[model samples]
Target: MDSLATTLLSTNLPPTDLQRDSVRQLILNYQKDVLDLRSQYRGRTSPLDVMARREHALQSIAAWKVVLSPVRRLPFEILGEIFVFCVVPSLRSRSTSADDPREPPILMSHVCALWRNVALNTPRLWSDLIFLFSKSLPKRGTVPILEDLIHPSTPHALRTYIDSGAFSVSDAPDILQQLIAIPEFASRVQTLHLKMGTRHLEDLLYDPPPVFLHLETLRLDICIGRRQEFVGRILKFLDSPTLRRLTIRCTYWEDAFCISLAPHFPWAQLVNLDLDVELKAAELVRILTQCVNLRQCGLFSLPDHKPRRYFEICTLPTLETLVIKGWEHTYWLFEIFRFPNLTLLDLVLGKWPTEALQVTPTFTLTHLALHCTYDDTEDGLALVLRFLAQSPMIESLQLNDIHGIGLIEGLTYAPSDNPVLLPRLEILWISIASWGDAAETVLRDGGEGLVQMIESRLHPDLRPSCAPAFAELWEFGFKCWKPKFSVSVQERLANLEEDGVLTWWE
Candidate 1:
């Protein structure tokens, strides 16, 4: 029977009619022999017992096949890499729950003995520990399960996000104490984000701060109920030699009382700083003087207050990006500081300041963004044009919350004796809020002016002779909060988009 089976396997096609009949007869004979053996066994064994034995043999074969599978033979190192890829996405997702059953680390360990061993042995799979501290602890038994998975020998980084808004003021201390009790918490923490009420912050002042030897980033979001004198203590707690990035945001107080309290931080070593707290001109100047090595800085609001005394101009040679959001008095920044290496400047202002048109000529800026909170004014176009003229090297420009018609007309290229406004421009994004009294007239005129401006920069025939001096305008975006553009304008713009000359977004 074994030889017959081998012969049948070698045949690549279906058997002939005679061959089928012979095979059928052979099967019947084998069945008869099996039945005779069962009858011979009598009450000692039955057909049901024989069937159970067959099922057991099949199961055994399947088990052996799984053991010999190609994936099962993969090297331990290769399997470890695959496991890292599987768990990284879940780790980065903000919504992933701590006790989620489908979390990669938990699910991978529960698969089988081999997988559990692999997951536990892979250090990277267990490297990042994110704890969300809220009103209550996570689901019961989650802490124990995590404790079992994490080993002391594995080098890991910890990220703790504390939200004290949901907890009562009385419960704040207990919640913070529990978080501080985690094994080797301070030594393992690399990033800490805290959103706490003023009461909770005061509670922290009473305890000795734990030294974080490896902290690199810290963010503090404080909701102030009244003026607190614990800013210096909080800064002391966050002092770390390895820290390079910091963010401090204060709510309910726009005065310099909170910021002025803590002026002795390690600002010289910081590389990235973002402050939303209000600051007087002198305080802002003092902070910038110490942050000589800063690469990116953001000031959310600068009160319209000038320095009481003359201060030497501050220069940040390494600063590359500056973001300022303020009212009319923000122009003082340009007059007081010099950013020789600055490449990008973003401003969100309540009004456009004419003094900003006198921006220093030493900057090698490439990108500029302006967002005005109020309605458009007649002088806004001229102010923007003059600003662009100074930064002739600007490659991208974004103007938001303004009337588009006047600016569009000014940018529309025309053959003249003068040079172009932004000869190196490559990106233009304009957002118009609303057309005032003459909505219909403004929309029609703005639509026409927009098409003209885009074509002059993008169309090969209409491009200026100095087009090769800079990059082609490859991206153009326009948004309006009022009526849609006329159909004719849309068709023209669509044609340009279809031709792949530029990417358009509305």
Candidate 2:
């Protein structure tokens, strides 16, 4: 019978009519014999036993299907890498809940036996944890799930976020107690992002911090209702030797300077610093002097009154990227220091200087982003163009919330014969928010000035001598709102897009 079955399978061509009929008859005869045998023993076999055998057969088939699945063939390492990609974003953002089905690691583990086994063993997938301590303690009952997140076997450095921003006093203690008790949890944390409220701040600040030997990045945002009490006390307990990135923001007050200047903060080794505090020019200059190795720095909403005494100039030798965010009176802070190696500058200014300003020609700036506010006037555009003319090496320029339509016009009417304001600007991004009424009103020109600026830069005459579109530029981006686009302007822009000169979205 086996030989006959093999012979039938081996034959590639269809069997003759007689051969097919014979094979069908043989199969029918086999079925009849099996039924007859079952009938003879039907009464002898127990009904329960028969049902159990059938269930066993079905389970065997299901198991075989799983074994033969193509996904099962993937090596554990490759499968683990796919799991990392799935959960990395969730871990970074801390948006997904513990039981959220969207979480890749959790979803992958529940797929099948093989996947569950692989996910459990892959330590890196379980290393990043987001524990939000709120009133409900949503994750309190899921200790087993939390264990899976911080797997015992996974020796990877943990990136942990403890958010108590929404927690009430009554609920925070329970979660904080539970989290702090986890054996070896704090010591393994390499990147810690803590957002603490008033009550949580009181509890955590008094306690000793865990040894974060491997910590590299620390983002601390504290908003205490009673700032005066904590202002005098320093929370400089967390000092990691390998720490390179530090971001600190205090919503209640500008007491970050007090905490940061402490000897235990390890500012000297930092490579990236993002400080959102209202500090004087002298105070900020004092902090910059310590961060010798800082490569990127952001100073937000800093208010400094120019002192009568001569303030020594602070030089940031290693700084490459700097962001200065302020309203009208804050532009003077830029003059305090000479950033010799700074390549990128992001300015969010409410008021811009109209007069010609001196920029250190020694510094080679390649990228500049200007985020304009409603307070900015039309002449501010000309002032910006003048600054660009000085820093001719700038390759990328981005204008966000730009209030004036004359910005592009200002650059167009430059007096030079080859009037390319930004000679090296390869990318230009202009964004006008829907809320900016002044911008939307003047933009009724149907974006003619924008078209002209792009045309001048892309023109054959300006291409060879000045900054050509070495790469395609994002000439314009209308984020949420659309301006009144005229037919002629749209048609012209469409042609440029087709020729691979520029791209815009509304």
User: Which candidate wins on TM-score?
Assistant: 2
User: lDDT of each model, Cα atoms only?
Assistant: 0.61, 0.59
lDDT of 2 by residue, 47-124 (tens): 666555545545544533333345644677887788777767745476655444566567777776667777788888
- How close is each model in CA RMSD to the real structure? 11.3, 10.7
How well does each candidate superpose onto the true structure, as a TM-score?
0.68, 0.69
Error of 2 at 137 (Å): 3.7
Off by over 4 Å in 2: 1-67, 90-92, 97-113, 138-153, 169-183, 228-234, 253-264, 307-309, 354-356, 359-363, 374-378, 408-418, 421-423, 433-450, 453-506
Clashes of 1: 0
lDDT tens digits, residue span 1-506, model 1: 45544544333223445655655666555556556555655655456776665455455445333433457557777887898887655333544443346776667777766677778788777665544444454433224444554462167676555555453534444444545555566777777777776677676667777778788888888866446555556777778888888888877644445355367888899898888876667888888889999998888867676688998877899997777775655777777888889887777645546665565532488777777664445455545555665786775566676654444444543333343356555555566654443344445664554544543543334333222221122123234422233465356446646853223122
Error of 2 at 199 (Å): 2.5
Q: How accurate is candidate 1 locally (lDDT)?
A: 0.61
Best by lDDT: 1
